[model samples]
Target: MTTPREHVRNAAGFALVWVAAKAAHRVRFRTMGSVPRTGPVILVANHLTMTDPLAVARVAIGHRRFPHFLAMQEVFGWPGVGALARATGQIPVARGSASAADALESASERLDQGQLVALYPEGRLTTEPDQMPGPARTGAARLALRHPEAPVIPVGTWGPKQGNGHIWHRHTACLSVGAPVDLSPWAGRSDEAAAREVTDAIMAAIRAEIAQAKQMWHAR
Candidate 1:
């Protein structure tokens, strides 16, 4: 039941946390393309670690924008994070719901109001830095097509925000955003069989961008 008004509130709250986190951690977010400054937009990014949101938030503030994260219900279940998620307008979805209808409705409403929605199509963090993004879901594609006029930005993030033990364990991390992909052509094809085509294309584009970032990160 996240409405456009909810996302606006979430954006405001995220801004405060982003400011504190970035300033305290000295983490920097870099962008490879001009982030759409406004409109019903979607930011599709690779999941590196739990701190992925921090990186995205920093970049958003740096770019002078606010983006709402489509988070998992588990994160919101935590007492503190749950409270934060509710206050900031972050969308929390169940791990395996009957249909992603609730999430879609919430996202559609936000997009209709011309707000940016950030989603991780992979459904979870990447254990292997180079593993091809697990077959992505079509939610993001559908969301993009819902707001065809808005930008469906494909983004790739590499490295770690601080720890270097694994996904959450890198001394430093970098983010790279690729050109936006428009999915208006596949908007109405909601059937699973038909949606797979759209999902594949988006996943391919995201993987391509992640590959580019992976190479750059390893080279350094």
Candidate 2:
């Protein structure tokens, strides 16, 4: 449901993002599909670089919605970056705080209120090409189970390619989005095994999306 208010907000956010991406002048690349025009959705993606999230978000904002991300507390405390981060609806995580209950509360509040959010399950930035994704903390699973019906869209970027003042403007920046992932299987699971199973399943879905995106992007 793209309410009148959200519609207005999306349009405005898109404008700002468009300007910023254009300024970066990176040749923005994308494949897969567009973010749904209307829905309570969760976005999942790889964390290969510090800018990985932002690189992925460039494509997300251009789609039919505004994206809210889960920002680490450190980033949330920075000066201008933090201000800008909050303005974009970033859910800040005070990691090490009782299994991230605070962030979950914030995510639930936003999703229940009808918003799109981006998450990096790796819990931190990536530095290598061969690392088999950091063990996901399962907080994302907890978040999704809390809202069993929201659509979870997985996104993957080919690269910011090492250093980056701007990649979105460079023609080489490529991104791919997977269809919305559903975690209904864990909707009612009560055991630890069931929980880990569900989390691994979700992680698999995200991994496939990322691998496909990376392959397709680099092939071109």
Candidate 3:
């Protein structure tokens, strides 16, 4: 359960991030379907750019859900950013290290506590020249298998590219949130094959949402 103090801290963090994100980009957000207002949920999204977390957070905050993101470990080492990440309860992922599994464990605990946990199954910013989502790692699928009760929601973001060196130039960003994925078929299955299948389905859902977000961005 979130303490009153933590709630206040999270709210402050959200406000700061929202304002900063707005100043950096013109963000357009939409919810294609309803996201649960309460309960534990696992949000999976395409990894577009380093700033994609901010776009996703905007959507989560709009629904009154304070998101605890599983972010890259290096981000936790940055000066002021690291302090805020820890203060807001963000989980750091030590990619390619044995300690990487610790992030999933921490995310599971957050879900058990009925908090929203957001992850990018892609694991890193997409190298795709077109900015489409790439193949996903199985951490998200494994987490879903462990907590079948928690809904897995797919989110898509567009307009944030990897090589944009213009930090001062405001860019247009679009976020689209999809409904909870149906995991009943994979229920009670925890094999490697099951994880692969689940991950593929989750990635597919995210890809579809990204297409929708891209259309929204173009229409804007």
Candidate 4:
């Protein structure tokens, strides 16, 4: 059941996100319907800049699903945003922990409760000059493999940042929602190899969407 505090938090968060999206000027949201309306969902997306989370949230909101991001533990301890994040139920991931067990357990609980959980498989912003997505962290795949009921959806987000500057000149960005990866084939295995395989498949889907977004950006 939804608590009064949660309801208030969600409403406030959505309002704030709308304001931020509008202030950012131009953004293109695509394939939002790929996320199902009701049920547990695990969204895996590529992270390029700090603005990626907001862009991803837009996609999820468009699909009528509220996204609970797997953010760093320190972020949840931040001054003002921390309180809001706690209220909104964002999962806190500890730094330097390879397994991210605390976060995974929280995420699993949320999934069992039929809520949408979002993660950046790359774990951090891209350092590459080309800004392509970095390696996939096993956490996302592990979560999916542990709970096979919730389908893993790959989301590609690009162009949240234009050049090295913070200001966006109404730049054209893309949020491509790819098809959900089928993980039924690896249901029983929770080993490193199975997790790696699932992570690769998810990454491939995300990369395809990224390529498509880049192509579309160029075409425009």
Clashes of each: 6, 8, 0, 0
TM-score for predicted model 1 compared with the true structure: 0.80
lDDT (CA) per prediction: 0.70, 0.69, 0.87, 0.82
**For model 4, what is the error of residue 76's alpha carbon versus the real structure, in angstroms, after optimal superposition?**
2.5
Candidate with the greatest TM-score versus the true structure:
3
Instruction: Please provide, for model 3 over 1-220, each residue's C-alpha lDDT reduced to its tens digit, 9 standing for 90 to 100.
Output: 5689977997788887777667777888889556788999999998767776877877888888888999999999989788878988899999999999999999999999988999999898888888887778999999999999899999988887675465567788898889888889998999999999999999989998999999999899
lDDT of 2 by residue, 1-220 (tens): 5579866765666676666555543535554564776667888777765556556667776675677888788888888768767666678888877757788788888888777878887687655556346677676776776677687777766645544444444445566677767666666764667657767877887777667766766786
Tens-place lDDT per residue, model 4, 1-220, is 9899878888988877766666654567668467999999999988877566777877888888888999988888778668867866789899697756889899999999999999999888777777788787899999999888898999887766633366554455677888889888898999999999998999998888888777666665
Candidate 2 local Cα displacement, residue 114, angstroms: 1.4
How would the candidate models be sorted by TM-score, starting from the highest?
3, 4, 2, 1
Highest-lDDT candidate: 3
By TM-score, the better pick of 1 and 2 is 2
Ranking of candidates on lDDT, top first: 3, 4, 1, 2
C-alpha RMSD (angstroms) for model 1: 4.0
The collision pairs in model 4 are none
